[model samples]
Target: MARFEVPDGSTVQAYRFALDPTPVQARALASHAGAARFAHNHMLTLVKAVMDQRAAERSYGIAEEELTPALGWSLPALRKVWNQRKTFCAPWWPENSKEAYNTGLDSLARGLDAWSRSRHGLRSGKAVGFGRFKTARARRSVRFTTGTIRVEPDRHHVTLPRVGTIRTHESTRKLARRIEAGTARILSATVNQDSSGRWYCSFQTLVTAKTRPAHAPRSSQRIVGVDVGVRADGLLVVATPDGCEVARVPAPRSLSAAQRRLRMLQRRAARQHGPYDPVAQTKRRPSKRWRATQARIGKTHAHAAAVRRDVLHKATTSLAQQHQVVVVETLNVAGMRAKGGVRKRGLNRALADAAVAEVRRLLEYKSRWYGSELVAADRFYPSSKTCSGCGRRKPNLTLADRVFECDGCGVRIDRDLNAAINLARLGEPADAGEQGPAGSGPVAGRGATRETDPAKAGDAAGDEASTPHHHQVDQTGTASPQGEAA
Candidate 1:
């Protein structure tokens, strides 16, 4: 039987492909994107004006009931207002499809809703400010939901509403085959230009994809732990619970390798007439040389990004397919990169080259696709400091120590290998057979077990589970007597 089977349910996925458009088509696409931006900015301006008017009225001692009514930011309301005023505001509205204008209004509506929810403390993350106007030269993109979008039978051309048929840089056989099989339907298409100046189209499709059994085959049910770091030679290390190495993939360092050429291109571009001249306090059009140099620089950066993404995808897919349970650390990449110094800058570059966060993201979705379970160890689990063989904890291990030596049992091992083994042990089930001898301590929940101090276990049990507290382990490998009460 085939490993995968299509179920009754459907899933939404995007198929993105590069486009090769003529100059005229590129201009038309840019116009549509610009129209969307104009509509968004116009609505935002009106909303802000109404808000200011209401505030001024209230300050002038106007009665609360007599204040100007607040402007609506809903999509339907915005569209209605735009329809009544678009003829006067945008005299060239007839030149573009209605989908272009709708795209802008929809974007504004969502942004307004997000801002309102954030101010009321209903949204997560940092407080969102009011939506800003979109600049023309930043990035251009537009979505078409009501348009006719389809892939040609030859899989070489795609037909989009208004844009007509355009050639694809690569074959769209995968999406074409699915559409022909009647298992997929394109719902929306978004056309966008990347920083590299390359145009692309993305189709959001409702697809019926086959899924396999969630469990790995019994004979291949091996668990592997992944330790992602920038070592002197490699980028990642995969090891099993027995401290056996599975794989070590080297980092390509694409960005670093392309930096010299990019620097030269940027220098040449800077010497030419650009869009703005700060010293002259005047705007100047970019010369042909400048534009060409800029494009070269953009392409170089894009190539580097593609290389990094390719490596990450291959590594994650292989690990997810081969292992039943994949374990990794929950890293705070932003925090690590924030400590700034000359040496820290180099470390930050290395971290960016490794792309640990992207690896984790790909691993998450790929694991689901390949029928593997992904486990994330706690951020403060101390996997590196704890010895995998003896389960002993070291309180003062330094970054300079590449080898982990256990004082309790005199067992020494490579630092990354030890950490990987410790992480792999976390994926083991609690009811699984014993891990080595009886004095080996707990394996599955070893990290959590260190938080339960026998001296204060009774008091801690009475505390609310939601209350926050720090988990500290002492030299004796037991939780500390003192706990922070919340």
Candidate 2:
């Protein structure tokens, strides 16, 4: 992977604000985004055509040198070709800034690279497909790397190339103050329209990050384990090594709460003339009423997402600043939400509403920002099934088992609290000195299955870095044999 090693104590950050543009400014912004879409579709068509022609010639017994010339997929090569054909392809391109065209080409270039790498097994995670042409319904966005991108002095407006100065929905005083102090430098600006037709401007900046403050003393040597769950009353359970529950953040359930309103808006839109013609197998212009209904639906979804994100951000920031060592479990959220039978759909929905995976992501970065240590327990550590008091593993545990009961020590506790306690122990100094999950103790039955976690392998995992918790046991009838992360 390519990396940019910045100077010490400097990091890239973004300040995003909502835009409140007049009708004329809005139209101009939309026009620039439309130009970007046009350039992308036109270039993609050409790229595909050239490849097809070469393949056809090969089948006709043409020599290698006689085949069609290869067309480069890189941004610079695309731009060269674009300039040669723009006279005829887009005569009205002068109305929009050149960065608009560059934005589309850059997007296509990156997509093509990712797709090629994925086809050759050079990339990880999900495989990328070929780039798709941007249609009218596609997302509208453009980036400006140069040309008069600045936050105005009043902190109420921003200046962009071709768009002039546009009023902002919120104050930009925070970013403007940083710029005035020379602590932050604007790198680039991106303008995008959301599904609700609201425009937002995000300023990416290179900022000097302040080190951990010496004035405010942090809770040093303290480890707090965070367990994320989908339950309404216990979205997050934070516990210490001594079985003390620090905080229990109740699930906001924003998406679940707005389901009724979303359903109503969707039904209203379905009754109107929409963009799709099912019988003709083509797209048509949607009615104004349908568009209005869609905007409302989009607004509802956006609101839900904002609420969930806000809650998560607050919870994570508070935890990172208070604790010296924060331990969270390694969860395969993608696999959890994978296509499952009808019985698993509700579980998946609840997990998504709670944004269980986002907890680890937030803590991972915020820990660094606050000069705290972040640790991820191994995926197969069995935090929930293992008895925090007696160190007994219950392989018969199921997802329906909300309360953890240990047969060895006869101890009972809340399932999430038990998991959090186990996680907290993983970050302890004594645990780090130990050899493995079982330490230097005697062996039991067959050991459990072990696989290196690709995501958390680089994290400071302490002693339980993908370590086996309990001896291998048959989990044939168990709903969640590995752990309670789901």
Candidate 3:
């Protein structure tokens, strides 16, 4: 059976295409989105009621599962509830498509499951709770699948499942060719409204390419170490051998400037004095001019995000295409940020700008696509403190020391380059004796053992990673290179 796994070698390529939607299509989208919100809110209410009933039952020595039927945990059961309550749905809600209603319940189901799991400490990320009834701005933030799904062409538009006879602002691309070649498969489609108030349909497609492996691994198939930093295009590209510097893309323009602008917009919005009554939770829509300005501010933020994503994609693609094996140091971003919570907004934004997670994720898929290997070193490998040439760990190393000075080998090198070289050294196959400290670390819980769940499997696999002899692979999920640089 086919299963989902993180991309390992370079094999995956993604393309994001812009879309154009017509007026009818826009209306359909609005309905679906609204219906989705309605379903989510309704389900939340149902769940909360069940919880309250269960709590009351427990007070009287009763059980929880007895309330499941009223809660409607299953999709079909929830749909039945929605069908019965259709009359109370918003007037503007679309009547034709059941899919819109289904979509809402789908989201609610996932949200419910997440909230349930998190409450029991069985899920990652921040704990979620039943959301408050949503309004326009807050409700707009939802993720929907948008892949290569074909639409039935009609006189003035195309028919979609939940959204019917929607017009397109632009014609479809070489879809006919894609269909003929049989390489494209429609995933799902999403209707998004831009800050410009323009609607677009984004279709996600699975495009297949006959990717060829790189011509023979560089005789220096020796691992290449990478040092990720916030200085260059969010990355400080260093080579393993001789601590060579390869790429130095400047930091993309920062969001700080845009953030200031957004703050100004928000402040202005807050200052609008009207016949506003605090007791009544209502507000008059802003003037057209004000709305225009707000949109412009939103557009600015969007542009910055686009630039960051584009740059990351290009850098990751380039790295994946060239190397047989990649080595990178595992960084403890969470731990590093813990001490600086006050400046976390800026730091977190910077981290995102660096796109460290995206790079790692992309490398996994790209490496699989290219039949290359990615080696991650342990978090405690001390890539920064240790000398690249010698196994001397500099306990006194400080962040201020951009250049590494090794007391043992009397060698000096750029800190990033040294780390990269160390990471590259770890790419070589290792013997049992050189398993390193990480491999020999203590095990607890299900430590590196078999797991039935996918999420747990990932954690288990991570625990099983052993430190390499040359460049140590550490617990932080990065690989350090060892030996003489390159």
Candidate 4:
């Protein structure tokens, strides 16, 4: 179970439990998921047909205002359309709760809205591609908003709208107690089956939890910076403003350890006959051996994911709870992956295994929950290149450099620890930077301090960092003169 604070004087939390369903219950669950997919596909087809008609009319030189209006993609409109055509599209629609169909229609509505917004430049990020039809073989999930959802008094069973009394693998006493005490209300429940053929349900509840004091005690106030990396010695390093080491945690590298077994399972599954026919868009029933092998692969992957998540959650929760202000570097994960080389595959795997983005995400939310502040240093802050003791920036620091030896101050330190200390100093007073040997301060403005010539920064920093360039810390942590260097 995980809890998140909501702004409405309550906490939005999810309690998930593994389900042990009978064969008949499994079939029913599958049917409901299938119905949801069917409804989505049906609405999409109708929408597409209407769009094609409008496009064709424009080709015939019809005025924009004279053309037929396109069909609506809103939930209510989609539901109305689905209701009119349900008789022909799915005669068994009544077999499942109305919420199942509503779930699919709502998903389509949101997708269409996002697509429209992206096309019109109203939405950020990569333009969303058009929504595609859902396939049965893919991951299956369905959410029920208006359902009779409750945890049984026995703390070992839960009841859903259409599915009655499903036993859980673990005790639900935590949620049961909250519900019994009238401190929480289940808003919605989602039932999903993973590739491992395991069923689980997640209840999103509104909980009113006792709020703790926002700030740490004045005497115990501590601000730390965390540097996350896959190093030979440790996975993470926490440092204080004065460049002192506070804590370190080793990387679990769960996926790396489980790779051999996963490869074997995948290979065995590939050898067995399965129902899927990509070229023909059809699937026959998979053989029992094939199913077994695939399930093993899925379980292996799931275990790795679980282990990775557990590590990240624990690390972030501890940081948020303990630190008053946490600072971290803004990493360019995508750019790191894009620069391909002999070690590209290995690097990508390590980056994925590190799960740095997930760590940041967890920290962001958990910090809010624990009343801590999280600061992201400029993406090109050059924390690694700048010496924590001297504030000298090294312009040409190579990847091979594992230890930072300050040219100005003559102080030697581990590269990661140096970076971590630099980050920790970011939240300190502005004069903190000038106290070092080079008499430098944190960048006066936001983003990475750039060089006058764009080519000097290269693609990784150049694409993101804007100019008028500031003569600041370089790649090697060596501070340059204020003016342009000849």
Candidate 5:
């Protein structure tokens, strides 16, 4: 799949606000989301059917061209077919805006394209799995690319297609001011309900952001390295090449703070009547009390997530705006969180809460916005084990050793700070106006590769169970680059 290129001098950004809709509007919104979900499942079923039919025909000695005509997997193709079939399959299609259905078709098209490219080795990332049927418990959402989508001048309400003006829980002045100034244009709007049954509207807009003028920062050292970890005091450490510790952001520990409440609520739900009966081995309708408990659980989780997001966004924005060149080490976050199962939960949970990868992801884009540069250290580079003092490598250093003691100079310092210094030393500062990076260290582009999933990362080599489904040969007995043939 080709990446969506933003226009010059403009960036794509999203503005999301919580919504407060009337009961009628809320139901209508849910109904529209349900329609989108239905379309996704409907089209996916047809696609699978066509693939299976072609494979069966091939096994019966039918020629390639003689097999059933292949269906186009593009958005226009799927939407066209859905439009034709809706009158019969969905007699109540007129209740929702067309954009509701378009939402699902667009998602389906992108998913199919990604899977095809991944199987053909044209995509670089984790192997894309075949799309699965979306159930009622799936995320409720619908995107509106067309129709009436706007923010009211009152700055407390926004309008969407089919769903009339809905009040926002917060002021929309942040986005409305930009809209009025012509600095931002809403390209699309999405209405989604989180697990807590709270509705939110996210406006994806193209923004003409102002870049800071290129100038030397106040700090003499231009490059700063950041080290991310699960440590409580120093979730991430930012230091200069000259060993000046500039910043140390403490871990928000949102989840840890709310863990007690979550545990109690989850236990209460377990004892109540849930959506399943273990003895019957089948699904069942959940009781009202169970639903209420689940809602509480979702709200707690959402609050924790919001707190974590706030902390991360602020930290990244500060780094991007103030630093000239920011260096960060590339880490396999997926590998780090894998194989936790019942054991090793604390480490994995803490790592996830820290969200070490997000700091890098946010800096990658924010750096550009601020006319700054982001440099990523090599994946295999051992920044933690190397002492900043005298550049001595401590191969025997372990996690328990919070302080790095160098034998060469008898220097003792915080391990995280030492790692940060090492990373900062990976490269000198790059010109803000320069088009290329200044790193002599092995430099890789964003999205150059994806980390393998935890389970697959540790899987034994040549293990069939760990292989992707698309790797299997098609019925034609020739290599099928795309999984549809298989």
Candidate 6:
């Protein structure tokens, strides 16, 4: 008997309501944020104090665990601090949300535990440390929680447990349908603000979704390989078994225009205000004339982001729906930038802004819904140099080579398309030793997987300080190592 784990698919739907907070309501939110911050800092202080005490006690032969009951990394102690400070909170602090303080403490403790482990040699990678207390500037950032939700459609209001009935910019999406059907149950509503200062609410809803069966037969699954680059043709090169060509999509006019406008605004902004001062910790507010320029500057950046987001969503959704498998090469974005020549900075910046990791993340979850698979080839996999048609590698490939010509097989095709086809051919197996789908041919770097030789290692990850690395994958799943492709 194959015992399968039951999936926890929700039978309820969530509704998001943008909050229109009164002055009083805004103050209450500030208070809640403060309480949360206070709890976090207080817990951190205790941790540091206890650790310091333990270090001093080592001379007396006292173990660190001796202070476990008094100054341990427990949430209860942090809650005690919250309980004591709760009295000093603003009058609007909801009594019903008394548990919120504890919730905040619990979250802080978990963060601390992760930080401690990362910092104290228990975890791999970099050491983590306590974040500094949130200042007024940082407090401008939005807060979200997966608890305390209430909705009243009659009054066109939604009340969070901590912060009461808030206004929304727009009515909840799909909430009315779910409510009418009586299948929706709201668990928590998380409120967030974007960079442009637009508020959004994400309702944690429990609703049923009709799982659609695949229209395409399982045996006919077509996998693809995508290689992304900054080029005139859609920045995406896709390769299939027949041949390779660029993925054709309408160029985003609005985004390109916004980028141009943003450059003008940036220049204006620079002229208005001098260089940034890290030590000063305050952005110099320019003259009254500059304020208008500032607003235009903010709007320009926000518009560009919105345009990029729309394009990315469309691209990712299409890819997720059409294919059963996807594979993409990881290009070294950092090294490309360091070997900077003309226009390298612009290319680097675009790649960073594309948010490749975010796209991959969206695809991973979206794939589950469609039963498709997405594979991210190792960063060292040389998709561009290797000929898709023939198994031979092209050692002296250049960026100017728009078309991929195989010396061994005499196959010529659009460079980007060939790379995409190669990635698609990789299919289910991307690891060094595994065989690719039947006739797709061997995966890249078959025998030269060893890392002992520096030259054969493909490219090295640049220093953290110098690397403008972004972990984002483009909609096509091709990753430029430092995050920019186009």
**lDDT accuracy of residue 242 in candidate 1:** 74
State residue 232's C-alpha deviation in candidate 6, in Å: 5.3
TM per prediction: 0.82, 0.86, 0.73, 0.83, 0.88, 0.71
Candidate with the greatest TM-score versus the true structure: 5
Q: How many residue-pair clashes does candidate 3 contain?
A: 44
Q: For residues 248-294, what per-residue lDDT tens digits would candidate 4 score against the true structure?
A: 88888988988999888888887787788666789778899998888
Model 5 lDDT, full chain set: 0.78
lDDT tens per residue, model 1, 1-486: 112222345544567889999899999899999999999999889877777777788789998578666666667777888999999999999999999998898888777766766676767876878889998776788888786789999999998888899999999998899999998887678888877899888876666653443553322537887888786455778888777888888888988898899889988887898888989989888898888888899899889988887887778878877777788887889888878888678789888877888766666655655556777777777788888877778879997899889898899898888888887777664215223332234342333221111111111111011111121112122111111000
Candidate 1 stretches greater than 4 Å from native: 1-8, 212-221, 341-343, 430-486
Q: After superposition, how far is residue 405 of candidate 2 from its true place, in Å?
A: 1.0
Model 1 weakest 10-residue run by lDDT? 458-467
Residue runs of model 5 more than 4 Å from their true location after superposition: 1-5, 212-221, 429-483
Kindly report which residue stretches of model 6 are placed more than 4 angstroms away from their true locations once superposed. 1-27, 57-70, 74-77, 88-107, 120-127, 139-148, 151-157, 179-184, 210-221, 244-246, 250-296, 329-344, 428-443, 446-486
Better of 3 and 6 by TM-score: 3
Evaluation by TM-score, superior candidate among 2 and 4: 2
State candidate 2's TM-score.
0.86
Off by over 4 Å in 4: 1-8, 210-221, 276-285, 339-343, 429-486
RMSD of 5: 7.5
Best by lDDT: 5
Which ten-residue region of model 3 has the weakest summed lDDT?
443-452
175-236, model 5: which lDDT tens digit per residue? 89999999998877878998788998888776776466457243555789899989789998
User: What overall lDDT, based on C-alpha atoms, would model 4 receive against the true structure?
Assistant: 0.71
Q: If ranked by TM-score, best first, what sequence of candidates would result?
A: 5, 2, 4, 1, 3, 6
Summarize candidate 2's per-residue lDDT along 1-486 as a digit string, tens digits.
222334556655567889999999999999989998999999999888877777788889998677766667666777888999999989998999999998888787677766766676767989888889998889899888889999999999999999999999999998899899999887778899887789998887766764455555665437888899999989999998888999999999999999999989998988999999888989899999998899899899889988998899888888878887788888898888887879898998898899998888777656666777777776666788888887888999999999999899899999999988887776764335422444312211122221212222112111111111111222232211121110
Angstrom error of the Cα, residue 273, model 4: value is 1.8
Question: Global lDDT for candidate 6?
Answer: 0.54
TM-score: which is higher, 4 or 5? Answer: 5
Q: What 10-residue stretch in candidate 2 is worst by lDDT?
A: 461-470
